[model samples]
Target chain A: MHFGIISTGPISAEFSQAIKFTDGADISAVFSRNAESAQAFIDQQQLQATAFDSVEALCASNDVDAVYIASPNSLHLSHALVAIQAGKHVVIEKPAVWNPAQWDQVWGAAEKHKVLVFEAARHIYEPAQKIVRDYLVGKKPKTVRLNFSQYSSRWDAVEAGEEPNIFSLKTGGGALVDLGVYPIYDAIYWFGEPDGVRYFPALAPTGVDGAGTLVLVYKDFNVIITIAKNAHSDAPSEILLGRETLRLSSVQGIDLVTEYTAGDEQVLFDSKATPGSRPLSELMRFEAEFFCDMIQAHLEGNFDEARVNRYRSLTLLSRSVNEVCTNARYTAGIFFENETLEISG
Target chain B: MHFGIISTGPISAEFSQAIKFTDGADISAVFSRNAESAQAFIDQQQLQATAFDSVEALCASNDVDAVYIASPNSLHLSHALVAIQAGKHVVIEKPAVWNPAQWDQVWGAAEKHKVLVFEAARHIYEPAQKIVRDYLVGKKPKTVRLNFSQYSSRWDAVEAGEEPNIFSLKTGGGALVDLGVYPIYDAIYWFGEPDGVRYFPALAPTGVDGAGTLVLVYKDFNVIITIAKNAHSDAPSEILLGRETLRLSSVQGIDLVTEYTAGDEQVLFDSKATPGSRPLSELMRFEAEFFCDMIQAHLEGNFDEARVNRYRSLTLLSRSVNEVCTNARYTAGIFFENETLEISG
Candidate 1:
């Protein structure tokens, strides 16, 4: 499978690097408004890929079978539509689109074109997720407390009067959309949509949430998702299933899962190559490979039983995650119906 | 201050035992519908006090200058009013009344009779509370997460077809009114009344909250209080004031407080008599002394500056704590305005 890169961002580079680990997937084209950056990315990565000055050019490329949409969040709808119209399977980064209307538009185009669209929420594909699902099969979860807070390295730049897109309100940026989506997706994936949602966000000076707590009210239990980009939390994230508990030392990548039951703990899944030896970048590679494998399986019309049973399909999973994120954002009072965009250069 | 006991419950015994540590407060009279149990209570502790067969008899005793109403929750309002009408100061157990109307009646009678009323929320009087207050002096707290969950020993009795008053719905018993009140009072003490409240409770078979999460929404932040009688949580409760965090190992008594700042932690207060060597019950004694001192000061008309600065008079603090608890309970759908009593014998 030949993949077309969307923007020349750090995530795009990571995706390109991770695709190399896959058997049949390769980056065939790169798209960037600045042609020089696109060319430089290909050269630095030593890839036999063409650089396109426009998204239209990349979408028109016959050599590319799929497109990886790593563009700014606000551009997901427009970019995904371009690839779908061109009959290319697309993989969009986390938070595929801002709200339900945008989600419907993107998925509508994908269905009409008969092309696959995947939201790159790598945690859903991690092996630890399977362990969590299996452990919670018979028992009912009473409460889930998820915290994904890390002081952003880009915050210094923002504090120095630079507009980093991740912290910008105009770019569909906020702690909830950028980071909170992980836990929200986990809740939806595990427990479906909540009966109600209440969000209490600490808005940044730029009118975006710097931190927030989201409550997902279910019939039997409540899921509390706390996310922040202004500070760090050393506490582990956990899901309480009555007398049993599933915990992750960190939610950033869900690299490991530990289950506690009846005063004893067992390590369910440790993504670390060795105990406490895995680097952060290795987890990103796993996410990249998962997305490529998913796209490949979708194209082959062979949705293997294992993959289908775990995540249904890319289209359904993306739609469900996007719906939950949109509803949560609305409840948090961060996203509005008519949001204006001021994308930074 | 000579005190009259309202009931022979375990809490009344705990209160009596701890009051011996105070300088001028003593139990002078005991009341119970069953004269034998009240007499047994005095004899068990070898007290010099007299046991009365009726609440009126104890309240009418000239030897009793104050009353400690440790009866079941449903009886607090009636018993406290009796003492107030008899011109005696009263110290009611935590959650002094069911709702705002009952609270107003008790406070109004106390004000009219010129008698002091105290709610025995011991943690509020602990030195740990002062440390938390001082740490949050100039900082704006972004979120406060409090958990005070303990698996109740009475749950087994309830499951075994026993109607223990603590889990009985008729006696105004449930986790929220009994355990959730601690965190609610903590929120009110630190952040005052919130702008809005949303509660999601898991109701027990008895139709009262077994566990629940309460969200107190402020203009800038939200306080999430989690309380349970159905289970236990080893997770420490926390208050986030930007980069600084104040944590309690447990909110049950807030025996110790730890402050985290800039990747380092310092113990702010440790209630242990010797370093790291205090039993849990010793902390409860600190709470008992606090109430006794406040009552003593009110009677002497010498509100020392330190006591006044730490906690305003018992009247103002009790009113505030009761108001917050009532509002929170109403939001949780546990406390209804038209609730009827079904006190067990």
Candidate 2:
């Protein structure tokens, strides 16, 4: 399989590397809004791929089989739509869109084009998260608490008066949209849509959430989502099952995951590999693998429950998070940079 | 000091044992509405304190210096008011009252009678809690997550057709009112009243909350509260500060509080004691000792800032929790057994 990369940002560069390193896929070409950024990608890495100034030219290149939309959050929907319209498979970063309506449009385009559309939510592919799901198989789970809070350096930039894209509402920035969505996916992927939802968010000066908490109430269990960007936490990026708890010490990578039972029992399932790989690249690799497997299943005329589940789950998960952030902003009386004007959007 | 037992229930029995085992206070008498219940307490304990048929007689007794109100949740207010009016200090178990208005009345009465009113929130008095708070003094605190969920046998009975008084809405029974208040207290005590609050409660068939989640937002921090009475979890009761995190394996007792810090640091603050002393009872002892110290300060006509801080903090904490629960019940259409009855004395 051949993959084209978009944006040439740091994330895109890493994803390009992961594709180059992976067994099944080759980095075919790289595109950037600026020719200089694309040329820099080639010069720095000494890559064989063609550098294109526009996405359309890159999509037209016969060498590319799929396009990876590694652009800013705000551009996910439009970029993916363009790629899907060009009859190419698409893998976009998490938070498929800024809001649900955009996601609906993207989904419609994907269905119309008959091409794979994947949201890169890496934890779903993590072995430890699967362990958490498997642990809940027999027991009648009654409650869940999922926490993934990593204080970002970009938040410090936002605090220092520079408005990074991650802190701008226009770019789908906020702790909820960026960080809390991880736990949201965990909850929905594991437990399905909650009967009800409630959210509380702490906003940056730009009105984007610096931190937030969301509670999803299901019929038999309640899941809590805690996320933050402004401050540090030692929260086990974990899923708390009723009988046993499956936990990861860090969201960046799983060094250790432990399971515990009622009588102070312990089961240590630690992945002893050193943290040498780039986390973002690992996530991109996992996304590509899932996409390849999913597309293969689709080609075989098989309805893969896991693949379809991922699609529907990410759709609803992103939608639900957007609603929570909107509710939080309304309750907090927050106004974003884009709120003051339509800005031809 | 002489202590009069307020109820003959199992909790009251435990209270009597705790007081007996406690260092400073002595059980002078036991009070119950029924003669059989009072006699059972006498038979079981082999105590010299005579049984009283009513709370009024116990309060009026010259031998009783303080009253421990361990009655049904609904009866806390009436019993507390009576004991305070009788010039005896009062130690009321949690859910202190149905509402803050009742709390206000009790506080007013206690002030007029020159007696102290204390809620037996033993977690506040625990050594582990103290250690955590002391550690946060110089550190720039950021986030806190408190979870105290345990499946109760009483709730199982409540769910199975019986409207146990503990599950009775009129009696202040529910997840938010019963178990959720602890996390709320922990948050407000540690961080202070939130700038905003959001609650998501899981309402049971009886209209009582089986479980709930609350997110308290401070200016630059967040506190996530997850609690339940109809579930089980091994998720450590956790507090996330900026510099480090203090995690307890069990929220119910003080054992080993593991502190994990930045740069791969780990410190164990173990207060493991011998078999003669239990963590929960040790908290009760601390509460008693604190009360003794407060009384001494009162006799000296000196206002103790620490005691005043605790009272003010608790009052604010309970008020904030009550506000959120009341709003949530209205929004969720939660019904208690006596919910239809006008909430009045």
Candidate 3:
């Protein structure tokens, strides 16, 4: 898989580094608004890939098999449409978009072009996710407390009276769209859709969520999600079953996961490396491998019903998470500048 | 100070045993609807205490100076009033009362009798509470996540199709009233009154909350409280400061507390005694000593304005927590029987 990295950012750099750890995936190209920045990223990473100043040029490159979209969040739909229209697969960053309507446009274009699209929620592809799912096979869980709070590295810029994209509402960015997506994906993919949702965000000085608590109401239980971009939670995320529990280091890149039943606790996954789980590049490798495998399956064309169902489920889960997160954020008075300027949007 | 135990339940037994750890406090009387039960409790603990079948007899006896009201939740106000009206100081269990109105009645009676009233929020009296409070003295915390979930011992009876008082709505029982009050008190006592509050309870079969998430919204932060009676949480409660964190073993009986600042992690308070703390009785001893000290202060009427201020602050905190917990629970559709029959009540 030859991937064309979209936008020269730290996340795109992570994607490039992650691709190196995969079996048969590599960065074939890079894109940035500034040609110098694109070339600088290419040089910094010492990649043999071409650097394109335009999304169209990167998407049209014959060497590129797919486009990894790490552009500013509000521009995802527009950038994704360019890639999909040019017959390239797409992997959008954490949130597909600010809302489902925008995601539908990108996803519809992918289906029309007979290509696959994945929201790069790398944590869900972690082995701990399967362990957590298997741990709850015959068991019913009542409450799940999922948290992904990291004090943003760019917060220093904000403190100096500057608005980084991650803390600015104009870029469709906030704690919910940034850190909250990990747990939102975990909750939806594991427990299915909630009956209702409510979010109470601690809005930042720049009119974005610095931190927040979201309650996903189910029939018998509530999944509480805590997320932040200006503060960090040292405690691990956990699911409280009737007589059991599953604990994850965090909702993102879970390197340590434990299951407890009665008087016993079993460590399901413990990487024993990196204080905050396997390094981001190493953990992100799983998503790269998964996406490459899916692309291979599409190229192979002759697949069984079970394979089709897996792909369908993954895409649906992605869409559902985007919708749930966007709607939940709207309830907390968080709004994006694109698609809808409506207050209660 | 001589104390009377109201109700022969587990909490009453704890209160009686806890007195043994205090400097000058002991259970001198026991009250129960069944005389045999009261006698059995006194006998089981091997305490030199009188057994009375009625609240009137126990409260009116000169053998008791204060009444430790550990009766069923809904009966707390009535029992406390009986003791207070008899000129006996009172130490009611966690909630004090279901609502502020009910608490007002007990408090008023105590004021008229010139006797002290205290909520047995033992956790706050733990040395760890002072450590956490002092740690956040000059710092601003944007989030505090408090969890006190214990898989209820009485849940087995609920599973056996019996509505134990802790799981019975008729008894003003639920996770909020039973377990949630600990975190509620921790939040209010440490952070003062929240600007607003909301609770999302996981209602049990008997219309009581089995587990729940309560959000106490401060101006710049949200105190997220997680509590359960039908399940357990192994994760510790934590305060998310920008560059520092304080982790408690749980929101209650914090045996271990660690503070992390920059690269240095400090063990602020570790009892080196018990896993969950110096046993419940040992922790409860703090409240016993505090109440006893307060009683002595009142007796020595030559006290300064600071002493009066401390008493006023403690009483106001008790009332504020009662009001906050009651209002928050009502939002989650939990209600007690003794209070107004209003649907939202």
Candidate 4:
């Protein structure tokens, strides 16, 4: 399938490169707010795709089969709606939209147009999920702790008086939406919606979260999601079940998953092919490939049962995550008018 | 200092063993509700002391200079008061009292009688405190996370229909008081008191917190304290100050303290004297010795400055921790009638 890229950000480049590993996906068009940036991105990537000066033109392109929205958080709804209304499948970056209203609107449009809309939360497709599933085959988790914290390189630039977009509350940028969403999505995927949610955010001077810890209370187990942009955590994320534990070295990008039982450590999943092989630098490609397969399966109509299940799961997960984020933000007293949008069926 | 033992439980034996390492402290009396249990304990430890049938009898014994109350949580206030009224200094086991009112009452009695009251929380006297202090010299912490979770050995017995005191809500037996207090004390010692506190507890079938996570919000940083009696956590507790982090391998015992800076780990303090020694079991003796020295200094009127500082610090910590615990319990909606006690000035 041919893919259209939106925005000329670093993530778009990563997505474009990752498309190389997919079975049936290629970048056919690129979109940027300005013509110069679009032309530059095309030239830099050495792609045969046409450069579109506007998202409307990109959505109008007949050469593109699906559009990948990598725009800022604030623009996700607008960009995704345009693509979906144009009868094009859409692959949105993590945090497809800030609030449930936008989520419902986007999905409503996608359903009306009968197009697939995928949230690009790649961790769900990683081998770590399979490892966790296999580990918890018969057992039950008592508690799950997920942490994804790193001192962003952009933080130094922002500290040096540069206004990075990520530090701007106006752009729907905050540690919770930007980084915390990963662990939130992981929890939603693994445990479904929580019974209750609470957030403790360290809001930056820009009125955005610089760091935060979120507790998602489940019936049998509690999930603690810790995320930060101004600091780092070296401790691995963990899932405790009685005396057994499943550990992921990095929650942000899980490269290794280990299980500890009876005081013995066993590696369940490793991104590396061999002990001495070059580390997997293009891990994001796994999600891209998975999305491509999902899109292909959905379009071909060969596996209706599997396709329906995937759609239902994805829709439920997206709605649950968006709702949890909304509740947490409100509870923390960091009110965003749009973020207060209630979940709608 | 000759000590009178209150209650002949497992902790009493542990305390008796630990008292052997103290400079001038000895178990001079053993107290139990029944004379048979007290005599058995005395015989087992081979103590050259009397076995009193009642706390009142032990308190009246001139051979005892201080009383170490190792009774159940419900009886700490009354036991300590008896010792205080008898002109004996007191060392009460942790969760010294469930509520601030009980704490104030015990301290008021001790003050009125001109006797010292100590809460025997062993972690405070460990080398971990000095290591953290040295590491954070002139620096402010951005965030601190402390976890102390262990699968209780008594869980099986409790599940088998045994009403172990640690699992009884009527006796103020719960993870928050039994195990959570360790990390709470750590937070109070390191950060003084937080501006706000919240707890999310997973209550057991007995109506006590089986496991829980507490968030203490300070002005510049927040502390996350996780404690469990139903499971275990292998993640090292961390104190983050900018890019530097001080890690404790075990928050409850802190066998090793490591500092990480710029991607390097340095072992700041290790309980092991040699590289491969047996690792200093019965480390609880250090706290007992510290208490013995404090009691000796206070009684002899020596080391006035050090004694005063230590006393003042311990009092402040105990009060702050009790206050935080009260607020957290209320916020979590686990209302205990005793937990609603106001902090006395």
Backbone collision count in every prediction? 0, 0, 0, 0
DockQ of 3: 0.64
User: What is the C-alpha lDDT profile of model 4 across B143-181, one tens digit per residue?
Assistant: 778877788877766667775778776688878888878
Off by over 4 Å in 2: A20-24, A33-47, A127-140, A219-221, A237-259, A264-280, A294-345, B17-24, B33-48, B137-141, B238-260, B264-269, B273-279, B295-340
Give the CAPRI class of candidate 1: acceptable
* lDDT computed for candidate 1: 0.77
**Tens digit of per-residue lDDT, candidate 3, span A1-345:** 789999998888888888888887788899998889999999998888998999999999999888999888878888999999999988998788778878888889989998989999898888878888887777767788988778887876777888888889888878888888888898998889988999999888888898898899988889999987887666788899877888887787777888886578988888786547466788888889988888766767855677678879989998889888988887787777653554346
Q: Runs in model 4 with CA error above 4 Å?
A: A157-163, A273-281, A301-303, A335-345, B160-162, B273-281, B335-345
* Candidate structures ordered by lDDT, highest first: 3, 4, 1, 2
Identify the CAPRI category of the predicted complex in candidate 2. acceptable
Docking quality category of candidate 4 according to DockQ thresholds: acceptable
Q: Each predicted model: what fraction of the native A–B Cα contacts (within 8 Å) does it retain?
A: 0.15, 0.37, 0.63, 0.24
Highest TM-score among the candidates is held by which one?
A: 3
With a 3 Å backbone cut-off (N, CA, C), the pairs that clash in candidate 2 are none
- Each model's interface RMSD (Å)? 2.5, 2.7, 1.7, 1.7
Candidate 1 predicts chain B with a TM-score of: 0.89
- lDDT at residue B279 of model 3 (Cα atoms): 57
On a 0 to 1 DockQ scale, where is model 4?
0.48
Better of 3 and 4 by lDDT: 3
> What tens-digit string does per-residue lDDT give for candidate 4 at A201-259?
88776677778889999886688888878776778888887667788877656767888
